[model samples]
Target: METPGNEERRPPTVPEGIPLLDEEAKLPQNERPELLIITGMSGAGRSRTAAALEDLDWYVVDNLPPRMLAALARMMTPGEGGVHRLAAVVDVRSREFFAELVSVLDQLRLQGTDYRIVFLDADDDVLVRRYESVRRPHPLQGDGRLLDGITEERQLLAHLRRRADVLIDTTDLSVHDLARKVREVVAGESDRPLRLTVVSFGFKYGLPLDADHVVDVRFLTNPYWVSELRHLTGTDEPVRDYVLGQRGATEFADRYVDALAPVLDGYIDELKPFVTIAVGCTGGKHRSVAMAEAIAQRLRDRGQSVRTLHRDLGRE
Candidate 1:
């Protein structure tokens, strides 16, 4: 919670150290839209991060040039087509132009713009493995080995990494996990509408990080142990029907969503940005997925935007 009088506190306003075009100076603005300058290693989950930000209702621009930061920020100002929050992904994909990014951000500060930087990184081995799994070349890789390029890229980003307001180590984070962390950090800034992420996970792979709250449905039923249902997914009608047929399934769903409604409503009313509810069962393929889909549908029926993910569903 913000301390009393916190809303009045503003970063010291500075005159635009750089000359601005007359048209730029006259652009209508609102409470400066929260600007997230996203830049990081290739295969470190930049795309996922941007998508997550978009899910939070942020206006996201991918592969944006550093020189365009000021213009983009001005264009995204509130009442400018109803844009409020903005996120931009700037990376080595910009090539040599990327070298100018720091100076561009410095200029923004001199102009008293309010913004934050989120740098996503992963362990070298992890990133290498990810690249291998995807069979994709790193943006920085040339004719030489990819690891060499990754090393050089890391060295180049060392300073920005230090200056980042939020540093996410994606080594152990799934795309959903990375998104959840970003949501949490963004949500902390103000009371704002939040996107609820409903993720289903298997106890075998552990809990999902995106989950702000967890509900264990292992107590509901073990479709995996049922010989007839072993190979079917929770989305199958039989599995869902069987699970819903349990003594407390319908009642539990009702009571749980009912209990969560007001709390979630309050959070949204306060403008909290995102909430995650994780449902877990013995295996992510069955019960948890069913419940998550049902809950997602229920929330959507109540006019909530929800992203549902079933982690471990396809894992061997």
Candidate 2:
């Protein structure tokens, strides 16, 4: 549906007098360095997938309109300051443009662009349950039943699912597991460094079993039991000092860091994809939050890109 004279409607061949024309110039012309198309069901973990790709040095574009795929892909190529690896998220959220993705992808293929489609999926029940638990409406739902939106999305995405080079069923996989799969698929022929994430959660909500490493801080003091500090988080100076002041807290943290430092350092040396360190406490508000922050800072001091998430912090 492009206009006959639109700028994006240029001839397939690179025009004459383009200075950067070369063998490498033949690569996909992208606006960002790498272009990724990320799309999936509302609860199917697209955000997590995008985050993982971002961690792996992929330039991630989230919730992109499907109509913009071809243009975005062109912009992500070499001459356009596009990085070589790009990931984008497209989904039901793009109500009108979503239908154009397949055609755009076809155009890319015809143009010999190097791209991959990753489809993240989960069982219907799991997705429904996730939506219910999060209290968030499905993207395709518009004054209709939630399941109707889910059904419509499934139908809409059927073609993409069939065409996906990688299909991940996240019903049982932890975020770490999903991230590992993403790393494996997208880490081809690249020398970029892997990024590590440490996610901390409360055991009350259940440990983040997807964590590559799980540390228990329940052995530390339960700030929830303290009337004065009950409402404060581990981010608070008093809570942090109080936790560190515990008899075995410092020792435990030191030994834990020592144990992990070598492993993480080795992972970097081997160029492994990514590692998630999960820390748990009785409640997400106090101990786990403190431990996660402490460990994140420690890793940062060691010169690593680290992200910390307190999964259960704001949950009821």
Candidate 3:
């Protein structure tokens, strides 16, 4: 569980600004490997995201000092930790250590080490609620309201957020939703089948900002109108039957699949790895969920790897 270079002998204080690499990094910069920086707001789900990456075979480092990133990269070896892919979960929790991020990024650039940053974010109100629910003070909150701490943290992270390679807004996402985003973004070519995520969401909660493909299924019948199925969700047999059994419901799935073939093909041909399809209805409770399931099954039948999520299944 030791992070790369974490327990190894080193100076008590790392030099400010530029990163210092060990002897292993002496080779020309062109030989460097891949690195993923997982950072962002304190309560925006960095822990869950990092855990998801670990499940996907990444060599995960928690709370690693930014200044030691280069050394850690250089120190990673297949025999020790199988660090072909390195993901470091860092945040503002380590105040001084985190301050060295900009300089460390510059060093990585100079070393030609490919790097991508996944920035996790959420709405202020949502963040406050999450903190309250957990009964934990915000990391930036010293002697003020939770909102004050959130505002301060947002200000601190504004710069890094702008530079993020992937920005995930978790304001309304479930843990599964966030995990799917993490998996899709980090999956290697070998795990390409998971390049697509099919999710069901309620338009009332707002569109899933992480979606690359937005499909509105509101045109379909509203199962909520039928009192008998109103309480049931898309996952339920009666609700699904009510939704898909409606006119043009099954047809829509068929035609949509045909229409998406060329688009999916183009993404694959262009080497674009991830796609999130958001299916929405008035309430994510019924119609959207069932259609999402049907569409996901169609894609699966075609041999594509896909995970279906109902973002507002019970929020109704």
Number of backbone collisions per candidate = 6, 24, 0
lDDT of 3 by residue, 108-225 (tens): 8898776898899998889988999999998879989999988988888889999999999898888877776776665443345546789999998999999988889898879888
Displacement of the residue 134 alpha carbon in candidate 1, Å: 0.8
Give model 3's TM-score versus the native structure: 0.50
Specify the poorest-scoring 10-residue window by lDDT in model 2.
Answer: 25-34
Q: After superposition, how far is residue 13 of candidate 3 from its true place, in Å?
A: 51
C-alpha local distance difference test of each model: 0.83, 0.78, 0.83
lDDT of 1 at 215: 93
lDDT of 3: 0.83
lDDT of 2 by residue, 192-266 (tens): 444678787878788776788888888887988889888888889988888888898877777787788778767
- Runs in model 3 with CA error above 4 Å? 1-32, 77-81, 188-316
Better of 1 and 2 by lDDT: 1
TM-score of each: 0.54, 0.53, 0.50
Q: In model 1, what lDDT does residue 299 have?
A: 84
